[model samples]
Target: MAEKIYAGVKVQVDQEGYLIDTNQWTKEIAKEIAKEEGFELTETHFAIIKFIREKVAKGEALTLRSIGKSGATDIKGFYQLFPGAPLKKATKCAGVPKPSSCI
Candidate 1:
């Protein structure tokens, strides 16, 4: 793990950049992470991020189809939101570990 600053807060992250502690997450941190990943955050992105965080906190497995069914956005919209890899990008921005289904 390595220490990184996001929105003026220092936190630990794994090699892949996911936060080592979810308690360290904040919307500002999410924005910084998103910017690093090549996109800007939006209300829609936050909505989806919130959903993903909640799911993970509750121990529910996340999948592209699960996110698509979230009512936040459909699959096409998810792809458009995160670009290259939706699940990976979304989980990273949400400050959660990369889902097992990712690779």
Candidate 2:
């Protein structure tokens, strides 16, 4: 059996085994996604930060600007992709001691 899932949590397990739900979209699940994506959990913060930084950098280099300049569209995608790292806590997870490239 498995615990009841609420919101977008797609997985369920209760001393039995793993059962993945296709419709789920939660932080803990996202964390698992990143892990499956070849990123270590302990460094997930760094992973997301770097991922954001890279994507932002790529966007900026072409336009001779920065990630902060992308406007609404960019912001929306960022939120969707890294939903686990909420806007409020992204900074701490990024682990950029003092902010480095505006990700």
Candidate 3:
């Protein structure tokens, strides 16, 4: 793990760039991470990010189907939002660990 700065905040992250501590996440941090991932955050993206964060905090398993059913967006829309490697990208930007489901 390594420490990185985002939105002027320093935080620890894994080799793949997922946050090592979700408690360090903030909207600004999320925006910076999303920007680094080549996209911008919208209310739609925030809705999904919020959903992901909540689920992770509750120790629930996260999956594409769960996210698609989140009413934030469907699977196709989720793909469109994050583009390549949607789940991995979304989890990364949401400041959560990369889901075990991802390779």
- Candidate 1 vs. true structure, TM-score: 0.97
Q: Mind giving the per-residue lDDT tens digits that candidate 1 earns over 1-103?
A: 9999999999999999999999899999999999999999999999999999999999999998899899999999999999998999999999999999753
- Ranked by TM-score, top first: 1, 3, 2
Clashes of each: 0, 0, 0
Best lDDT among the predictions, by candidate number: 1
- My TM-score estimates for the predictions, one after another, are 0.97, 0.25, 0.96
Error of 1 at 98 (Å): 0.4
For residues 1-103, could you state the per-residue lDDT of candidate 3 as single tens digits? 9999998999999998999999999999999999999999999999999999999999999999999999999999999999999999999999999899742
lDDT of 2 by residue, 1-103 (tens): 5654433553554332223332243446545544443443444344555554455444432221332344422555445544653442342233212233433
Q: Which stretches of candidate 1 lie over 4 Å from their true place?
A: none
Q: What lDDT would candidate 2 get against the real structure? A: 0.40
Where is the poorest 10-residue window by lDDT in model 2? 91-100
